[model samples]
Target: MSELAVPGIAYGGDYNPEQWPEEVWAEDVRLMREAGVTMVSVNIFAWALLEPREGEYDFSRLDRILALLHENGIAADLATPTAAPPAWFFRAHPDALPVDRDGRGLSYGSRQTFCPSSPAYREAALRITGELAARYADHPAVVMWHIHNEYGCHNAECYCEASAEAFRGWLREKYADDLEALNRAWGTTFWSQWYYDWDEIIPPRATGAVPNPAHQLDWRRFCSDELLSLYKAEREVLRAAAPSVPATTNFMVMYNFDALDYWRWAPELDIVSNDHYLQSTDPESEIDIALSGDLVRSLAGGRPWLLMEHSTGAVNWQPVNRAKTAGELRRNALAHVARGADGIAYFQWRAAKAGAEQWHSAMLPHAGTDSQIWRDVVQLGADLRALAEVRGSTGTAKVAIVWDWNAWWSVELPSQPSGEVRFQDLVRAWYEPLWRAGVAVDFVRPDADLSAYRVVLAPSLYLVDDEGAANLAGFAERGGTLAVGFHSGAVDENCHVRLGGYPGAFREALGVRSDELFPLLPGEPVGLSEGGTASVWSERVRLDGAEAVTSFASGPLTGVPAVTRHTHGTGTTWYVATLPAPSTLADLLDRIRTEAGVTPVRVTPEGVEAVLRRGEDADYLFLINHGDRSAEVEVPAGAADLLAGKPVEGGTVTVRAGDVVVVREPR
Candidate 1:
């Protein structure tokens, strides 16, 4: 907690020395050194090697790996190899096998296949983690404790008696032993699914009651809690043995594994880390990554986070995996650092030869360290190590965007007019303009204090759970302009739709009632004029106390409110009825900036994305060229691009594609 101290941008990744021979291990060490890898994450998937049978363990291979890493002047992030249960353990306790939607117990082959709520699995996992923690907790080479990897990918719940009983207990605690209350919360009246007893409720599966959303929603919440309990148990063991070592697991971003609520998990983590992978070639890719980075940072409350698992090149599992361009990896890495990352680590180090991810990118590809990919890795490492301090140093951002998981969960869980409403899309729309404007931003959930910002943007915001609507109202009442978008506040925390009307709980604050929703079909446009279109879901609303700021035209909702505004205590709440094109969003941002008395942090000459990260007396200005052509950016005539150690003259600094120019302005 004392300012997370890693030597530098901790590099190196899931290293499995046990996977190869001694000679190959030696070669890997040499290659890692060349790649500027100072930190090695070892023993990620070595459970099979560590313990081949029940009540039996071996630590020699891991000892050698840790020792070799230390001997080479590299740090080791020791993993408690519980990611994959040993075949012996799974064989010994067949109950450890996961139960699928069809009630079939899963066979052990892939990793992340153990049920979190299974007592047998928990006992075995605890024993292994406890043993490992006790054995290596004090080793000088060990820097952090990594619990199970990607903790919640397995199917949720087991129809086995153990899980059924556990679910009953959970139900009793949550609903006070009242079946009626439980039935009401789950809205069990639908489909004649009313529960007579706690035993009547079963884990919702894809096969049965597919249309029963309430039951499915509860299942999601239950799954999230179950996995969280698993993580807590592992952390408990690690904390007892290695109290000083920060413990965490890598979180997959926007993942459907409902059990891992990052917001709830963030505080428990010594350092919040996330894995993000995308296959898009669009300009919005950077914006998406930036939003995710900010989300992690906000979870850490502005503390630096770790880019736990990014690929060096193409990912193998995506439907259409594309290799990163020459400079794309570097650009993405720096983008995270610029936002607020303390470290960067990839999913793998050595290439797998016979697994599902065999073709996934690695630090040492199948071609070895002599390949072009290896050269890129080495160059990137050299650059990071060269500018180590600046890369790790914290940056301050004035503007913030709120990201809430509860709202996301409860909002989309409900059956709305159109199943096409995506909360992630709305969030992206609000964030892209701020990113393009070079506005330094942080992501806060609705409950987070909004007193610091001149403008707060909450897009989609469908549920407004966790005091979000009130906070937005408070921010506006306190003279802060808030821009909220479609489906803002329609449900409560219980997944119950707000009683009054759509935007139910927030209608009074926003001064509008959503009367009708119009779904835009493919190839159809909700005209914003000037050739811009909102081509997804459109809404028709009438303003009560709010004034119509923008209107839809040439569509079913034409002349209705596309955007509306209401005067709150001292500021305003603007509601956008549909997802607008970037130009319209930018225009809205311009209006907000003017009304909120805010200005662009700094303007670049052209072709560069300029961002300012302010510290007390030192302001870090990042001028990155995301465009194909070289960009000339204006700086204070004599201010230096600190990372390059070159001074700017006549306020001009030119940067090439994927190039980053870091300028430090001293007060």
Candidate 2:
């Protein structure tokens, strides 16, 4: 499959020409040319304007917008405009609106208020998509189809009657209409929750007590499937009408509000794309950005993916809305490129004159083209053009981190072992060290192929089915080093304990079994045998064949194994019994990396990132310095810095803070 339809890195972003007058479009195009903008995502939220009433369609504004974009030599990532249904449609079909867990119907005015299972909403959405595809399928400016805006951003789950009925139907198909099987899987017999018929099965609603864990799990699965079904319906229409244009929907990969399982959704997309906004509040937001990019690239199966949306400056939604510092914007853009993004797009072209996002930053800020944001945009555009040869290049990684959304949901469900045990935090605890060590890492699903990786890190997995457990064991048995962190392999898919032991399915592979879990109180930490302390959670592990690498020096779990390593077949399995401090975690990973013989792409001092991207004939090393002082980075001999146009025959390159250097070497 083709990576991107455009020539260079796709630039520009969400453009809403329908929001402004016609005269402003000419100036918009002029500014786009001045800024070297190559593409724009248009008509994302124009449903109200596109269809004022049922069966009524208008394309006059859209036609002019596309024509203007083509005239300015800008490609269009055309949107289906189904994210926000028209107010009139919702008024006519109130059943389409979503209801919260309290059973209160959500009103229009905000985007993504329609329930995924509403038949009326589905019909209207598909009808408009057909109209859109029929009109612009062959347009010269349209390069790709941007299906509905971020799916399930607001109302991922609905407790309304329509959704309840749909949920029952989905369950019937999944269980083959066998209530006995459903009862056994859900363990409904535990609390008199057994069902005699499908109709008796409703979505876990707002009960004072905790809902059935199995029901909640299935409800999440069903909701994700429903959203995927909607995307498929529109994708089929676009495929029939405009088979040439690839279709994609923007994914919020690392966002807190994500509902759809992106692993399942990635297969439905013709091109993998994601929308990532920086968290200004977190000092480590850059790390999150890199993580998200790696995940999306992995979702594309090591192919170049598109960065569908990022902010040019401060996002209006955050509490503080802090603007990007002087060189931060440029660094942020290049970080995505270093990971494997063929496109760097933003949330908007022009700042909204009036809306919820009126204060949001755009390529052309409200200050016009005279602002710093516009200058940065133009500079990034030029940089991307100069590095056009980097397009379609891929990054290689020998390290894989297992990330599963089901595991995330299961670990965070109510009544777990520890309320403070966050899945993302645990994963990041392992990822940050690898990132700092200049190691290229891929985020893989639990069932992903493990042969390609020499080392795999699974942190706080908490939920693993039989197939997933076997996959891990196979990886270890086949000469791959595996690291399993605390709380993994505890439960089956239905949130039921595996019944044999803690770390249930993986007990044999890990060669360690836990008898009890001890969660520490805040500010309390147990000393590790290696001279550091472990906190948050600790397990009393008894080793079968594994040798203890680190043991708890004090506390209730004193002298127990805090970290252990066992050899199985030709590989080694390492288990972490508690969350170690940052320094200790890095030390542990460094030892594992060395033992696995996994080489870093480039080793540099702290605060500097080195990533290698390989093309057909050339390899590019991207060196980014995130620290305040200059750092010396060792580069390949006879390499030429692409940005500076200088040869680095000295074998070391000095990079200043907040700057990026791309070293080009002949493959």
Which model scores highest in lDDT? 2
Model 2 weakest lDDT span, ten residues long:
1-10
- All candidates: CA RMSD in angstroms? 2.4, 1.1
Q: 590-612, model 1: which lDDT tens digit per residue? A: 78766777766677654567666
Model 2, span 360-476: residue lDDT tens: 999989998788998999988888877787888998899999989899988888988788889888988999989999888998898888888999999878999999999988999
Could you tell me the lDDT of residue 23 within candidate 1? 75
Model 1 ranges off by over 4 Å: 2-5, 154-161, 176-178, 207-211, 254-259, 280-284, 529-531, 605-607
> Which regions in candidate 2 have their CA more than 4 angstroms from the true location?
645-649
Candidate 2 versus the native: TM-score? 0.98
> Which 10-residue span in candidate 1 carries the lowest summed lDDT?
252-261
Every candidate's lDDT: 0.75, 0.89
